[model samples]
Target: MKLLHTADWHIGRRLHGFDLTDEQGNAFEQIEAIAKKEQVDGIIIAGDLYDRRLPAESSVAMVNQMLQRLNLTDHFPVYAISGNHDSATRLATGTPWFKQTDLFLHTALSQAFKPVELADTQIFLCPYFEPFDAQQYFDDDSLQHLDQAFARVVDEMKKAFDPSKKHLLAAHFFAAGSSTTDSETNLTVGGLAAVPTDLLADFDYVALGHLHGKNALHMRQARYSGSPVKFSLSEAAQEKGVWIVDTDQTPVKLTFKTLTPIHDVKLLTDSFDHLIHSTDDPAIDHDDYFGITLTDTQPIPNVMARLREVFPKIVTLSRQDGFSTQVRYQGESGQQIRQKAPMTLLKDFYEQVAKEPLTPQQEKWAKTTLKQASEGGQPS
Candidate 1:
């Protein structure tokens, strides 16, 4: 059986406070093209079909349009699940009605263990979950997490499975092998969620998600398809793509379907005078988005306008002049301190950010003011 594996659509997500619906639309167009080019027998999206529990009306329309385009007319069966960001009930509501078109949407745990069989392939879908869901599922009321929850779910699935057949698992969770960045939002709170690679031992192939960068989980038996679009600047060089799985009723082999988006994100740093007029450098792609930083002792005049001419998609520009920065020592509040004493803790905080010590007079003034605020008396 041949399948095109994709997930983490994250529809209606915002980047730098700008709506990404149009970019997302473009991504779907690429997906359709790939699906057509590959002529795969089926498509399986593991999870995270949307960015929010309650998506905007426009996002709903966008998802509907994309799904309709993929399965309705194309005649390929699409089996998907809901992730931590989705509204399970909302996503599963019209699922029965939509099943007529070869699109299988599974959001509830009751329906999760059921395998979707197609052409000698049995795919087990598991969505993202919190500690509570597992706690409720097992009725244990303890700190059940990713490892435990997945173990429980997969164990149940194993009980009813025909081990002789090729079993593929589709999931969304943070794998321990993957690296994280400052921009990544915590998928599971309290550090209770994380699954082991070995937990899915019985499955022939595991298509995974959640981490945005592509990775080889235990030599590609388990893997992350990665996000279709670059979510943060940290993921600047990610080769965003989907996975193509071909199962031979014994083992599955994966092929990374490469996707090249129109815009490339570049980070450039130079002195404003040289950079702004550096036409001699390789011609910048007018369509690429750039994050350029100007580093100079003196501020450059008309910097943004000049660079915008060269890089049409320059969204962010920063100046790294020394004076462009600020060093402020924050006290408790505006009325909290006037001056600090050598023995004062509040005064100690004031010295940290500024990297300077408070003078004697300032300390005395602060002590007097603090004393006055402490009592009903004025600064003495």
Candidate 2:
């Protein structure tokens, strides 16, 4: 049996406030093309269909269109699950009749016990769950941590595992030994979300989500397909794609298929002079999202405004020369620095960071904000 594994669509996701709707749509189209070219029996979306639990109306429409094309139109069976970012209740609304169309979306933890049996494999769809949910479901108060709850869940899944057929597990969790980037939200407090890989070793293959990079984990049986597009500047260098699993062999053969983003995430490091001058150069694709590191020793006035003129999609900016305003106040004692008026401090900090003094309007607004803060009132 051939299956394409992908996850973390984050359909409504944005790159530093710039909308990624077009980019995500492009990725879905590529995924459809790859599914057709590979002729896979099914497609597995591990988790995180949307970037937020309460997605916008437009996001819902986009996801609906994509799913309709992939499952209803293309005739490929889709096995999906909800992740930490999804509202399980909302996703579970029409799930009762979803399987009729070969769309299996598992939202609750209880839904995982029943495997979706296919030609040669039984896929257990395990959605993202908290320890409390598992504890209540199993009536075991001892299930205090995610790993503990996951152990019981895996044990329960093993009881129904048919030895005659290959078993596969599709889950959304931060598995142990997986590295994380800035884009992924922490699933639990105090690192309680990490599930041990040993518990997952029983399955023939484990398809995971939550981490945005496919290389986040190095286990032989488990893999993260990663996000379809770059969601954060930290993921600037990641090669986005989907994984293909062929279970016809003794051990499943895994192959990666690349999906090109509409606008790639990139990092450009150079002085302000070079970047501003390079705007006229044809070699640069200024449409791509960029993170810039300025090499100039001195702070430049209206730096972001100037850079945005050329790199309209600049997501982040930093100075590599370590320019600081602290040198001016090095001789002042901590008590002396603290004695300065709030407005004076604000003006100094703004001037140092922005490389320009505040305008009359900005100063007025800052004074009003300071007064409101001092009075324990919210700023208007």
Candidate 3:
């Protein structure tokens, strides 16, 4: 079976505050063209179909129009799952109605084991799940970690696995050894929220989402067909695209086909003098998105307005001074701050900000207020 693997569409996503609807719409058009050109058997979108839970009506319409054209009109089957960003309940609301069409929208834990068979390949959809949810679902209190939860789910899936047919797992997860960028929300706090890659060894192809790079996992068979467009300044250099999989080969054949963005994400650095002079450069596309790093030590007035003349979609502007060259007074300063009492620090901060020490009466009031606050608003 020939499949076009893509994920993390994040339809309503914006860069800074600028809307990416036009860019995203163009990308979808390209995707449709690619699908038609390739004439693939089906399309698999792993997760993060939208950027938010309650997407704007415009966003809803945009996605609906795109899906309608692809699944209903074009007559190509599309299988998708909800990511961390999506509200699963909302995505699966039209489950019954969607069933009549070529679109398969899987959301809940109950949907994981069922395979959507296409030709010789059986695609298993495993949407994002919290550890607590898995713990409750499996009736196992020991499912405290992500790996444990995945192990349990995959184990259950194995029992019903058809060894005769080629199996593919479509999942949204932070797999071990995958490289991540700033745009992705942390899947877990403090503790690592990653599942072992070997856990997915049973499948011929493991199509994944969550981390936002096509080559995030660095594994051949198990791959992430990253976010189609750049979502953050950190992802400016990332070559955005989808993956084409040919499951007929011994080791399934994989190809990375690049998708051109309407507004390319880029970072440009130059002094005020150089930028103003290069306003009419034909080589530069003013409409493309940008993050400008100004080399000037002093702030220039109307810099953004002037730059917008040459680069209209500048999202962020920062100075090199914001980044420190070395650790300055780290241990001693930290130790001093820790050694000082809370009340003393507060008094010192007040003095610094006020430019005067508190009067005796004011000091007494401050102490009393601090004591009351420490005692949870009770007199101490």
Candidate 4:
């Protein structure tokens, strides 16, 4: 059967603190259009259906609308699961009703190792499971790693797994060969939980998720479709898309279909004043969202206002050195700050700013300047 494989929609997710509801809405429309145009038999979302455990009202509405449209034709089925970032109970609340309409959602650990059979194919559903959650499933306490837990889970799945039919698995976790963005939150700590692609040899194909980047584990049988929308600055350069796989015919064909979001987000480097003043540039005039960096030593007051005046959708700005935390004040209050500082507070502030105490010579100069200020003399 032809199946559209996708994951990590992260619907209702905010990028750079800018709400991406409009962008994500457009993405959902595009996904529906692609599904219809391709005439796929089913769509499989590996995991991470919603961006949060408690989704906003608009997010819930958007999900409902998208799912309804996807199943409107009633000819194609949509299979979904929950990831580490998702709340299983919330996502699985209406699964019983969705199943009546050919939309299968398995978001509960209680339903682990269940196989949904469709047209002679057994599609195994295994959502992401933490060590503590999967503890009871393991025979020994030493089965602490994800590899060990999944190994045991797969064995259980195999018991119910129909080996005679073409087997396909859906899961969301960090695979050994996959890479993650710095912004991606870790599901588990240490190295106790990495599910290798080798764990899926028994299944004909494995659809994976969690890593935002696309492509298989450097091989073909297993693949991750990545997020359909960019979710972070690290993902600023990625091309969001979905994967389509069909095995009904001979030798399955896998296709990656690109889904472009309405609002394009880019990390743009511009001269401070140029960014502040350049309103005529095409990139600055459009509805695109931009995270700008002012490559200057000092930023003027009302910097955000000036930027937004030129680029209406400019959401974030930072001086390249802004990430640098050293603050050297030279105003009239600088001397008072130097003289009236409590050592504890001073040390805490310095630690927060990633700095050490001033050198002996510098400290002497500061004290002298403070003493002069105390005597009604200007600080040197």
Highest TM-score model number: 2
TM-score of each: 0.79, 0.86, 0.82, 0.79
RMSD of candidate 4 to the true fold?
7.8
Each prediction's whole-model lDDT (CA): 0.74, 0.91, 0.84, 0.76
Runs of candidate 2 exceeding 4 Å displacement: 188-190, 280-283, 324-380
Cα error, residue 51 of model 4, in Å, equals 1.8
In angstroms, the error of model 1 at 13 is 1.6
lDDT per residue as tens, model 2, 28-145: 9899999999999999999999888999999989988888888899999999999998889877877888799999999999999999998779999999999999999999999999
Question: Which residue ranges in model 1 land beyond 4 Å of their true spot?
Answer: 188-191, 216-218, 278-283, 301-306, 318-380
lDDT digits (tens) for residues 1-380 of candidate 4: 87888888888798767888888888877877788888888889888878888988888888877777887654569888898778888887778988888888887654667788876688877777776667765546866778887788788788886756788888888877666675467663345567877887787778888888785365566888888888877777878888888876444578889997777778888787777666677645346778788776543657787677667777677887653334444333656766756544455455545445766685677668767876899875
Relative to the unseen true structure, what is the C-alpha lDDT of residue 331 in candidate 1, on a scale of 0 to 100? 21
How many collisions per candidate? 2, 0, 0, 1
RMSD of 2: 7.2
Clashing residue pairs for model 2 = none
**Order of all candidates by lDDT, from best down to worst?**
2, 3, 4, 1
